[model samples]
Target: MSASVTKMVPAAVILFGAMGLGGCATKSYVREQIAPVSQRVDALEAKLNETDGTAKSALSQAQAASGQAQNNGQRLDQLNARVDGIEQRMAESQKKKPRN
Candidate 1:
């Protein structure tokens, strides 16, 4: 039992030493691994901002077009009413003329 215990103590020390030496990462090494991912995140954020700007512009244009269409519709209604009044006066003037 004593011989086995003495042999295990050295084996345990070597295993623990190897694990401790291999487990830690240097700051430079960590930065090298993370740099590409950071750049990708920044690029995606820029693209998202650009898309958001475009969407806002499109929304404003659509609102302006809607207002213009409504104005055109109101103008058409006024023109239609004037045309009806003119047609009624023309019919009355024709009826007053002699049948010839």
Candidate 2:
């Protein structure tokens, strides 16, 4: 019984050691597998943040352009009114003159 027990102990120790080493190896492999995915996700997040910033900048520029266009349109309308007034005065002056 003593010989059998001694023989079993070494076998049990080797088995447990192998299991521990295998667990460590599996953990390493899992970390290796997930590392690339984590890096890609980080890269994607950065790109998304950059794109969001660019979109906000574009929206602000568009709003500014719209405001400027509105101001230009108002100025154009005022100029058109002034031109119409000048045309009316010219017509009146021409009508008052007798043609040769």
Candidate 3:
């Protein structure tokens, strides 16, 4: 019995050691598999950040354009008003002139 038990203990120890080694190998393989995915996620996040910056820049440009348009509209309105005043003065002068 003692001889058999001794042989069994060595065999069991070797088997358990092999199992531990296999577990470590599996962990390494899992890490390898996830590495590419992690890199892709990081790249996507960077792209998203760039897109956000572009959106903000576009919004700022749009606001500046809107402000310029408003200024142009006000200037146009003032010009129209001036033209109307000139026309009214010309009409009044024509009425006061002697008939031909």
Candidate 4:
């Protein structure tokens, strides 16, 4: 048991020493890494805002186009009805005229 303790003590001391050195290096590296990620996050936010604006514009245009289509359909229906009425009148007039 004494021999085992002697071996473990040295290993524990070495491990603790290595961890202490690693802790200092890790802090500086983490700080450097965080800066770029923070900048990228800001850039992503700007892009998202731009996308949202474009989507809103497209939606407004689509709504306007849909309204125009409906108006045009009604106008077409009215024009077709007028043409039918004119054709009917011409057919009656032809029947009344004598054969030529």
* Candidate 2 local Cα displacement, residue 81, angstroms: 0.4
What 10-residue stretch in candidate 2 is worst by lDDT?
20-29
- For 9-96, candidate 1 gives per-residue lDDT tens digits of 9999999999999999999999999999999999999999999999999999999999999999999999999999999999999999
Which of candidates 3 and 4 is the stronger one according to TM-score?
4
The Cα error of candidate 4 at residue 93, in Å, is: 1.5
What's the TM for model 4?
0.74
Q: Can you write out model 4's per-residue Cα lDDT over 40-94, one digit (the tens) per residue?
A: 9999999999999999999999999999999999999999999999999999999
- Measured with C-alpha atoms, the lDDT of residue 23 in candidate 2 is 66
Q: For candidate 3, write residues 1-100 as lDDT tens digits.
A: 6999999999999999999877665768889999999999999999999999999999999999999999999999999999999999999999999998
After best superposition, candidate 1 residue 32: deviation in angstroms?
1.3
Off by over 4 Å in 3: 1-27
Indicate the residue-level lDDT of 49 in model 2. Answer: 100
Which has the better TM-score: candidate 1, or candidate 2? 1
TM-scores of all candidate predictions against the true structure: 0.84, 0.69, 0.69, 0.74
- True lDDT of residue 22, candidate 2: 73
Candidate 3 lDDT trough over 10 residues, lowest sum: 20-29
Per-candidate local distance difference test:
0.99, 0.96, 0.96, 0.96
For model 1, name the residue pairs that clash: none
